[model samples]
Target: MAKKVLLRVYGMTCDDCVAHVKNGLEKIGKNVDVSLDGNAVLDIDNDFDPYKIPSLDVFNGRYKAQVKEIKDD
Candidate 1:
């Protein structure tokens, strides 16, 4: 089952920061869905791999998550 999650990220001081976040999320897998405005949303289908991502602490920001919305597709 797929679910939508909202992530609040801080320290995105520039567009490159956004790109870095996007690249990090995309590297997780093609099966996952994600987006970023200021924060990021992960529409998860299954448990995700944490190892695939480098430490986000590099971004120096807050990361918070919650279920936001769900869509059937």
Candidate 2:
């Protein structure tokens, strides 16, 4: 099983920040898409708990992440 999750990210101020977030998300799964507007939709594995989504620590403590929505796929 897989899950589609929407994430709300904060403290991203540029393309570099976006890249950092993208990299961090990639560490968890391959199907991750991030937008400039501080939003991301990820296709993650069933075992990948959305609640465990990392914070700014994944990006050198310069950002924050929260789950906005999640659904089974």
Worst 10 residues of 2 by lDDT: 54-63
Best by TM-score: 2
Off by over 4 Å in 1: 29-37, 49-73
What lDDT score belongs to each candidate, Candidate 1 first? 0.48, 0.82
Alpha-carbon error at 36 in model 1, in Å?
Answer: 7.5
- Model 1 scores a C-alpha lDDT of 0.48
- Residue-level error in angstroms, candidate 1, position 50: 9.4
Task: Write one digit per residue (lDDT tens) for candidate 1, span 3-50.
Answer: 444555555657676666666655543344334456565544556533
- Superposition TM-score, candidate 2 onto the true structure: 0.87
Best by lDDT: 2
Error in Å for residue 52 of model 2: 0.1
lDDT of 2 by residue, 13-45 (tens): 899889889888888766789987999988888
